[model samples]
Target: MRARDLVTDFPTVALDTPVHEAARLLAAQRLPGLIVVDERGLPSTILPGTQVLRLAVPSYCQEDPALARVVDEEHADRFLRSLDGRTVREALPRKPRELPVTDPDATMLEIAALMARTHSPLVAVVDHGRLLGAVTLQVLLDQAVGT
Candidate 1:
């Protein structure tokens, strides 16, 4: 199947958006992640739920002193880890070394190769220089292991 077949055309967030807002969006939609975008309409990075969780802890600690140190240190550590040596353009991956990408006509086999090589959960699907959506490995496995 084509990447577009399982791709999710969801809303994106900007880098400057408050961590709280980003977390709300993910929770409201029950989504795993959001595509973080730059002003030029190009994706900058992928902000996954884990990033939101870390951000939330600090904000939540505001009302409870007990949680303050927890977020400030533990969760703060996670945020730093999420951005570990990452440039503004790096797509977050289970494996951050190589990027997984495909064109409009890429077949399942082509994506599988890239996924194996990059250990990517999601592969960016582009059409004529524009990002359409991402084909995630989880989606493929879900279909293959359908109930």
Candidate 2:
């Protein structure tokens, strides 16, 4: 199968999308991550859901198990409130990384290899410079298992 054949509708967020809003969409859609598009509507980055959670939970909580237990949901939620003024760009990792992308004509193996190399949950299928859709890990696995 080609990457285009596995492509499915997926959410895309703008670089300026509010961090909190993006997190809500990620959770609501049950996605592992979101495709961050640039001003020209080209895929720019991948924002992993784990990164969102990392921002929501305090560093102290992550560093110490005991401190985490002391934090209630209400308190934990306060950390997320800090994301109000932040944009998706602000939430990106400090190190730059290429967004996982595949041509529409790419084979499934090529898509899977790219995903594995990038450690991304989904790979964007690009036709020229435009993003057509994404091939998610689940979809790749389903194809691999002949589902």
Candidate 3:
């Protein structure tokens, strides 16, 4: 299958998208990650769910896993409040990397290779610098396994 055939209408977020809103989108959709788009609506980066979770966690807990167990469930549940007033751009990794993007006509193998190499959950299918849609890892695996 080509990227065009595999592409689905996945969610996209802008740099200024609210962290709380983004987190809700991820949770509601149960997505592995979100594609961050630029002003021109081109894929800019992949914001993995783990990265969003990282924002909810306190640095102290991250530095010492043991500390997480000490916090009460009520307090722990409130961790997501840390994301309040933040934005997607602030949640992005400090280091920038190439976006996992593929051409609409690209072969499934090519798309798979790109995803594998980048360890990305989704691949943006662009046609001549314009955003088309995305091929998610789950969709790719389902096709491969004939499920």
Candidate 4:
């Protein structure tokens, strides 16, 4: 199947979307990541779930992971509060990774190859620069194993 055939409506977050809201969506939907769109509704970047977690963690904890272990469970639970007053744009890496995109006619192998090469769990399908939908890794895997 081609990208269009596999594409399914998926959640997307805008650059200005509240970080907490994005985190909620990720948790509620159990998504691997979210497609970040521009004001024009075009895919701009992909925000992996790990990046959101990274934003919640303190730099000190990241710098020295052992520091993370020292934090009591009660305080560690509050780590996500760090994302308060933050926007999705702020959660993004300073240098964005290449967006994994494909056209409607792209073959499954082409999509798989792109996913593998980019290490992205989602691929945005664009037609004439407009997002049609997305194909997630789970869907791709299900199709691959013929389950």
Candidate 5:
């Protein structure tokens, strides 16, 4: 099967966007991370769950409980800080900024290798250099389920 069929309508964020909005998306949608996309709507990188933690915790104590407390105590502050106007570009990792891509005709092995090399859970589904969707580990595992 093709990646297009596997894409799971996951959440997205802009690269230059502030760290805050992604946090809210995680809280509201209960997602682990968001796909950071460019202005053209192409994904630039995957913003892992941990980055949001850094933004939530204080510099001295960066623990989950403390961060959760910060959230509880500073909902307004955090909300105001989130993706207020920034794009994903500014926040994208300097390393491996884009998800690995392959033609629709490529085999799952090729895509899997790409994912493995990059250590990314997802591979952006592209066609002729255009963003289409993404394939993730969950989708791959789903096929093996119930068998």
Candidate 6:
């Protein structure tokens, strides 16, 4: 199958969107990630849900595994409050990883390889610099297994 055939509805957010709001969307929809669009509404980056969780989680918890047990859901929720004033662009790494993108005509193998190489959960299908939609890992897996 081609990328165009696999494209499906996906969430998108602006670069200036509040981090907390983006996080809520990710959680509410159980999305793998969001397509971050530039001011011109062009897909510029991919914000993975894991990256949002990384920001919510405390460094101490990551560094010292024991500290994680001390953190309850309430505490974790409070920690995410720090994202209130931050924008999605601010949450991204200074040197963000490359976004995985494919043309509509790309084959399934090509899309899968790009996702694996970029370690991305979704790949955007662009047509003449415009984002058509995204192919998620679940979709790819379903196609692979003939589901």
> Each candidate: what lDDT?
0.63, 0.88, 0.91, 0.91, 0.64, 0.88
What candidate 6 gets wrong by more than 4 Å, as runs, is none
- Candidate scoring better on TM-score of 1 and 3: 3
Candidate 4 lDDT over 1-147, as tens digits, reads 899889999899999999999999999999989999998999999888988998999999999999999999999988988798999999888986778999999988999999998788889999997899899999998898997
Our model 4 lands, by Cα RMSD against the true structure, at 1.2
lDDT accuracy of residue 77 in candidate 1: 60
The TM-score of candidate 4 is: 0.94
Alpha-carbon deviation at 63 in model 3, angstroms: 2.3
How many clashes (backbone atoms < 3 Å, residues ≥3 apart in a chain or on different chains) does model 1 have? Answer: 0
Clashes of each: 0, 0, 0, 0, 14, 0
- N/CA/C clash count, model 5: 14
Ranking by TM-score: 3, 4, 6, 2, 5, 1
Candidates 1 and 2, the one with greater TM-score: 2
Give the clashing pairs for model 3.
none
TM-score for each predicted model, relative to the true structure: 0.59, 0.92, 0.94, 0.94, 0.64, 0.93
Off by over 4 Å in 1: 57-100, 109-121
- Model 5 Cα lDDT, one tens digit per residue, 1-147: 666656656667776566666667878986656777777887667666666555444554544445545446556455446445654455555666446655666566676787778766667776776776667766666753732
Off by over 4 Å in 2: 77-79
Write candidate 2's Cα lDDT for 1-147 as tens digits: 898789998889998999999988997989989999999888898878888888877788788969988777787657778778889988899998877988889998898899889989899888988889899999999999999
Task: Name the lDDT value of residue 129 in candidate 2.
Answer: 85
Between candidates 2 and 5, name the one with more favorable TM-score: 2
Error of 2 at 127 (Å): 0.6
**What's model 2's TM-score?**
0.92
